[model samples]
Target: MAARKIHTLIVGAGQAGIAMSEHLSAVQLPHLVLEKARIAEAWRSHRWDSLVANGPAWHDRFPGLAFPDTDPDAFVAKDKVADYFEAYAAQIKAPVRCGVEVLKVERGPGGRGFRIDTTDGLYEADNVVVATGAFQKPLIPQVIPADAGFLQLHSSQYRNPDQLPDGGVLVVGAGSSGVQIADELNQAGRKVYLAVGPHDRPPRSYRGRDFVWWLGVLGKWDLQTPAAGAEHVTIAVSGAQGGRTIDFRRLAGEGITLVGRSGAYQNGHMAFADDLARNLDRGDANYLSLLREADAYIARHGLDLPPEPEAHVIIADPECVSRPVRDLDLRAAGIGTVIWAVGFERDYSWLEVDAFDAAGKPVHQRGVSKEPGIYFLGLPWQSRRGSSFIWGVWYDARHVADQIVTQGRYTAYDQSARARQAAPESAIHAAAGDPDGPYPHPHL
Candidate 1:
């Protein structure tokens, strides 16, 4: 294939990339998106078959579009969510080329722009936006031996309970994915053992409103990253069974054994951290904090939302999980599979740029990197806490698009184009200095 030049090039066609494409197309910016797989491939292929989105459809969709023929409060099934992305791309007429795998991104000839080498052909672009997102590589710890008799799989590789071997299953990690899988497997009549860890236990719905709405109304969604050393954690909310709070005590009551964090696995015996009770206490505290904050907000604002008498009531921990259980022999317990629902990290091996630090993480203020003409999207805490959600990506992408459109020579080109077209998208510039400070230094 012959080489070509494009004004802007975006990698990855997931929600983040698609949202970026939407904003770029708004100002008639010439750009194209290159995707290694089909649009929203993560939702279509990677997620478990029985999985539904963690948030309600109403709050989870991009602003310009809504889930078709679905209730706003309903948690959308995984495949339908993927369909929504595909439909959105078609609706916006996003310039996407699927199956074009980008291999490397290096400086263009004469150091002018970026040269992207792909499986299809080579191309040059004046600007590049890396939108592959933060969930690039699965982090599977080396606790279990490679030659271990039990089958091990990362949560990304898991499809359903049927995919696991016939025996007890141990699910490590207590995040959203871990709890959901454990619940699914338990419902299938499989003996499931879950390993608990640090997590937020916010109720899915409180006082007749979804927790998501409460976050936005209470202004918790716009939270910035805490000063370094406060480890980032995720909420353990679930949308299964019509969405509700996650309680380990209740799960233990239902016959699923809850254990502490997983440790070493040697000679068929698996060790665990003796912190299950402490982890539960931490989650309980987070849950109570939200309830109290909601009450205070309601009183201060004089809102007419209903109140529950038992909103602040937390049940006692079940006896089985009140204290950490000691080590158990995997073979004796008949545990045949281990699902590592730990987490993921970003992979920038293909990115040949100097915008990263010694830790291999991107060094950027907001989405704008230190390297000129390069940007990133779909990163956690990119702008705020909401940056990880679908609706949040809208604002982050808009900001990046603003910086790109108002960039060096492109500003002049954009001004002339707007004059000729007789429609100026001046709002992008107007909000550049808005007080929320989602992007502290747009120029930087």
Candidate 2:
């Protein structure tokens, strides 16, 4: 196509990207979704055969449509999710360009809108929505000492427990990934070791009630306004409120050994944090506080809820190795496989914008950034419950797309325009403090 300026451009064709495209379509806004890889590439690349949606099918659906599976509690396989995304893209006829990698997104020279440079070509748009999820890169903690003998693999690369070596497996991080991997290994008849950390222990549902039901009732998941900063803590079902826990007790009952935080794994032994329980307690408190706040909201709103009682966590560690990784020697014990299921971190090196914080994340509120016309979607806890999940992208997509529509025609910043209305040089004062401070420092 020739050099044509578009109304809006959404990067990524995954769930979030497609959802955003649908919202734009609804508003009759002209837009295109540029996908770096094939649609739902994340799900396609998950070669694991046993991968399933940790939650139910009814809850794992995208906006305006539901997965056509019968099992509500059944886990949707990776390939199926990918297929669903493809079908979704087709169903909505989302204007998507596949195999187009966005190399850079920045203010076009004079701030006239965003210049999106891709591998295939270049396009200009009034607004850009980066719906890339947070799982772009795997995060491996530096605390663990590197050794020549041990093979380290992040959870993203792992597919099945049979791929592991003959020795016992050391699974780091006790979140969903950690617990699930450890459970699979143990079920495979291997001596599995899981490292416990602060996590939610919510039941999939309470008394035939989906957890979101309670959230909806409480209005905790209904945060529509933009937050000033990130949430310090989240609720966990695994604490004293046992009902919501992810059934870790059942895993322990099945012979999976749980342990404290893994410190540094040098020669062999892994040292764990001495105050593991204390740390967990603090995390649990934060989670409970969030839940209480949600409950308060429901009560105040007069949400009609059943008289079903709330459940708490039942802490169990039958095969738990409470010692830290630094104190345990795996080399001597013949534990050769090390699965780092800690989690993923976002890396924004490719995003050439000036609004990024020290952590390399784009600073924004309600999908809008200080950098005009730049927005983000599908971020973890971006808004409320649906922020990070596959089903939650539509909410953000609609909100951001609406912004673009309301903004009307976009104007790129030009040098001549800046020169005409530019403020005096003395008017721009320098900062007197550290450059690495919270907000961007104009003074150097």
**Best TM-score goes to which candidate?**
1
Full-model lDDT, candidate 1: 0.87
Model 1 CA deviation exceeding 4 Å by range: 227-229, 410-444
Question: After superposition, which runs of candidate 2 have C-alpha atoms over 4 Å from their true positions?
Answer: 1-4, 144-147, 223-245, 279-326, 409-444
Q: Against the hidden true structure, what lDDT does model 2 obtain?
A: 0.69
Query: Best by lDDT, which number?
Result: 1
Q: Positional deviation of 245 in candidate 1, in angstroms?
A: 0.9
Local accuracy of candidate 2 as per-residue lDDT tens digits, 1-444 = 644578888888888899999998998988889887899888877435566665456767775667775566555777888888899999999999998898988788676778888887788987888887777888777755565577788888888877777888888877666766676688888887777765554444654556655555656566764344434223333211122355544666777656677776555568776645554555555445545655565568776755334444435434342433336677775678888877777866767877678878778887877677788888876776657666666777788777766555322224323543565554323321435422322221
Candidate 1, pairs of clashing residues: none
- CA displacement after TM-score superposition, residue 355 of candidate 2 (Å): 2.2
lDDT of each: 0.87, 0.69
lDDT of 1 by residue, 1-444 (tens): 767899899999999999999999997789999999999999988888888988999999999899999999999999998899999999999999999999999988887789999988999998999999999999889988878888999998999888988999989998999999998999998888899887788878888889998899988899988435435665699898889789878788887888888888788899888988888888898888888898898899998989976767777777767655769788788889999999897799999988899998998878998888899999999999899888998899999998887684454555544654564457555544568532333254
Tell me the TM-score of each prediction against the true structure. Answer: 0.91, 0.79
